[model samples]
Target: MNQNRVQASEVAPRAGLADISILANASLTSVTGTDMTSNAQGSYDLALKYSGTGLASVGVADKKVLVYALPAELQGKVVGGATVDIDANLLPITPGDIPGVSLLFGALGTAIDGVDKLVAIPAVKAAFDSLSTIQNLGAYQETLPATVSPDGKTISVDFTQGFGKYVHQAYVALFDTLRDTIAAIDVKNPIAAIPVKLLQEASADLFAIIDAIADGTSDILDNALNANLLGSMNGTLHTTVSDPGVASATVKAGAINNALISADVLTATEQEGEAVTLNFPTTAVNPIENYDVAAPVITQPVAGQTQVAGQVTLTQPIPDGTTFEAVVTLPDGSTKNVPLAADGTFVVDTGSLVDGQTISAKVVATNGTYTKDSPITTATVTAAPIENPIADYNVATPSVAPLTAGDPEITGQVTLNQPIPLGTTFEAVATLPDGSQLTGTVESDGTFKSAGVDQLAAGQTVTNG
Candidate 1:
């Protein structure tokens, strides 16, 4: 369980898109760790040098830059219960100078007002309620208010762990709930003159897009954390942003996949100004190792004539609070884990194993403190006995009898000493006293019936084959 914390230096933050001039020379300088409640707090220091035409030209006034750590990527690396904090020193643009920032906030308020009015309509309210019950129609946000720095030149982004995963879970849960709800709705009913069936279809299409966005975003986040930038300076940093124009800038953009980081901004701005310095920091973590233990005993398996597989047993008994997992490796290099029964017996399915194929098996035993694997046992799969085909033979005895009293129709049975193959049928022919032949099919069980035996007399001699 020993591991090392991933450093921000390992992943260089790419500058915002080339079109975003304000972020021309943005780059991560260093990442430092501080002891937190359960684990260390990850702090990333980034510097963005202004190299654009001007903040006035970019319409970015009062727009706060954001940086977020991906919790999905840090699951086993950090302890939970750590709070995420954003330092107030990252915003350099002056709030008073940006008049458009007010306009942006005003526009957002107007949009909210419009939504409130729409929700007042009975039909609209029902639809909205339906969506809300399935999932939060509103965007997911855990607002942590941060103020602009007085000087506004240096920005430090610190996110410990857990929060990003919570956000991710919220998103996944929303989509999953919505998908399930839509699937359960009765499609035959009409809502607002539109068939509910159509809504279900539209939901399926929407889910496809959501899945792509969710999976792609997760991949980008994962790549940002684990990408091997061993020797290359090019790397991607995960980030988030806040702006007056939207409830949560990251949510408005549909997620942090499009957040602006300093690496690319720094690189681009440096080409226009002086070189910016970059620093990388790293930390190590170690976990306790398990003590060595003894391996379990294994028993060989034998293929049976009727079964496609063989039974492999654990001859030795296990102690309480212990568990064992057995894995079998076939000659083709495929491995299968077989679960043991209460008696410690497991079936090694060799139906797919070719003739003369060899197999090896081992058992891993785990107690409260340690896990140990048993010695590998190898054996050739035993071939099952070949079955002989049913021998061909003629019916030993064929006889006829009256099916009912005073009736010409008759029923009879043929006899054989050996077992009859299933689905086997035979044609039964009988010669009546009038020299006419009556024929019927004999079932595999040797039973048959025939009609139109008008000349048949009881107790009279009749020929049959």
Candidate 2:
């Protein structure tokens, strides 16, 4: 038998039998030759074996291959010339001669044919193409060597291949998809549960979902807690207390509301068709019992009145033992305080008030923290009456001048104790020489000159009529 005989070129080109290597003892060798012997004319039994070994350290070892041949007719015969002419042929063989090898080869060939048929299917081919594309993706192609932990419960993935740069994008994309899916779910009628397989496959994503739900619940609770009904009621009570009549009620109501909220009996949110009733305890004291006192009202010396007697009176009666003071604003812009009498009436002296001057006065209840002022009242001072002027007539020294005629003319000036009226005339009569009258108009200086006095003698007494 020629053990190193190369196979005829016809067998070398057959599909699934080309360029095959079988490994043994941690080494690889190619099936480069065949052992054959002629059992009879035109008949042969052949056996194939691989030779050589690969590196044991690389883990490519202890591998073997089995070959089986089939007896079949050739379509063409070899010519007797130097160049042989042959045609392609198909063969059929009986497998009883090397049952072990035949069975193994049969099983492997069946499996390969089945795989070939599956790959030929269009849908399967498309699925394989998609898988190939995914495998080639930048994110997936970045591989990490996996390491088992010491206790075998955890595996660590290597991060030497720029894992964060690529894998983070994939993680972000996955989370975005998950967020969108959750957002599309209707909260009113949400799905009962996530699919178990999906949860198992994406536990990280499920954790994210749980976190989102927890955050939303926390926000809702925060908002509810912040809507403090007790606080709001307290504010309302503060505003209501400004009105003295409702102060006691508002305070009691606020206390009750606070107690209810503290006891969790009241919700922060307003409920429809429900009212919060605040009941005060029987022993609760009224807050505004002493707040009934008000600012005094002045009615006696009415506004815009002239006080001839320079006194003011208040008509509104005060309680017994309640003393009040009046703030009087004089016309000169100065202020004075006057005490009220026991009857709530106050008198203001007009000594400081000028005639015809207007003054403002307001009454302030005194001797208590609740003291308040009344509305301002205005009054004018009375004008003084005019006095009549007095008049007195007096005699003046007479002077006589010698005239060319028979009698000398007498001239004299008369004076009055007070000035006379502008249009009044004064006259003097002398009885020494002749009965004659002398008259002159009085001037503003209370002096009068008697002019054109004819036949007037010296030292003659001049009298006015």
Candidate 3:
């Protein structure tokens, strides 16, 4: 990498213009010593100073445009510069033709500040009411480019129109006057600029404005102002200097490095003291056009669900030429890619997952243009229930013996359709002919024997007991 610093601290301004000096400091990788190459990236930290005679003649409201003409080698390769800055000396800031809805935000901030201070006045209230119309507009947002010409040889800065213009004249003028008025009012009355009744209403109006903007109404306003948003090739607001003969001010153009690197400015070789001319144009030749690139959306395997065993399908349609992959994180801290069928469905084997463990899945889609990852969907593992086995068995009729005096007994058999478990036991209860009962134990062979069979009357008979 080669580094160079072009310092022109004593450069004389135009005969009638302010004395201006520019210092260009950059480190381009392709530039080694005094030689340079083509298409190499580099960093730029440029600073400019304007002072001396005739600077006072530039009125606060007047527009000041500064243009830098670079070598032809740096043409058509610039990109990326941003941010708007200003000095406190520049009071009553003016609005500019910024490149995007950022102007609206800037103005919105001023309007909010003004409303905070002077909302008690009917006129301020009316202006706030008018500003509320922005609630219906769409936010006009897009990718903005660096301020470089198509040839990439010139970098322009419209100081007065770009920076000063961002400070809303309407809000600033109105509130500045109101603030002065409030400062003059007698402390005893204090009610002229700060009305008691309108105080609550003003707060409500402020909240309403914020709520409307939050609810997407700013899109309309954004779109309306998209033509001049911050990222556009518009210049930044450096500072306002006012002195007897001259005002020394250091102005830094942020993101200009990206612009230089993107444009391959390092490829252009120039001597240390080569004269770089600064020109002024009445209008910006290139106005940024609004464009949008939609990001892929994911709608399948809905996020936040529990699954025991099932297939999760990617319901979202993938564009042609785009590649899709499903990433699954398993319970054991391992990740795997689940293959998807043509229909975008893939089943996860929950049986393999441990109980109480959670698995997550997401889809990544990539194409020549861009890549996108879907929101993560997770499923918890749950164990299935367990059931005991049922036994198959049958019972046989009991055999009764004659009740001979004191001896009375009954025998029966109980068998199982399957093999008998080793420690299994059974018992039987017999009902006598006289409605009495006796108990007995059954052997593993399935035989049952009992005693205490009682005799019955003539119509009754001895029954197994």
The top-ranked prediction according to lDDT is 1
Which lDDT tens digits does candidate 3 get at residues 326-403?
777667767777655566655554334455667777766654335566667776555654532334334444554444
User: What are the lDDT scores of the predictions, listed in order?
Assistant: 0.39, 0.31, 0.38
- Candidate 1: stretches off by over 4 Å: 1-62, 68-258, 266-288, 291-358, 362-380, 385-411, 414-465
Whole-model lDDT for model 3 versus the true structure?
0.38
Candidate 1 weakest ten by summed lDDT: 246-255
lDDT of 2 by residue, 1-465 (tens): 344454453354321211221212211111222222222121221111112222222110111111111111111111111111111111112211122223432333343234434333233223323322322112223222233223222112222123223322332232343334333433232232333223223434343433443444222212222211111000000000011111111001111111112112111111111112212233323222232233343333433443312233443333322356777776668777877665555555534445567777777654223455666777656545553433443434433333333243334444454444454554444443355665555444444454565644555454443
Candidate 2 similarity to native, TM-score: 0.20
TM-score for candidate 1: 0.26
lDDT preference between candidates 1 and 2, better one = 1
Per-candidate TM-scores read: 0.26, 0.20, 0.25
Model 3 regions lying over 4 Å from their true place? 1-309, 314-318, 322-325, 342-354, 363-377, 391-410, 419-442, 450-465
Better model by lDDT, 2 or 3?
3
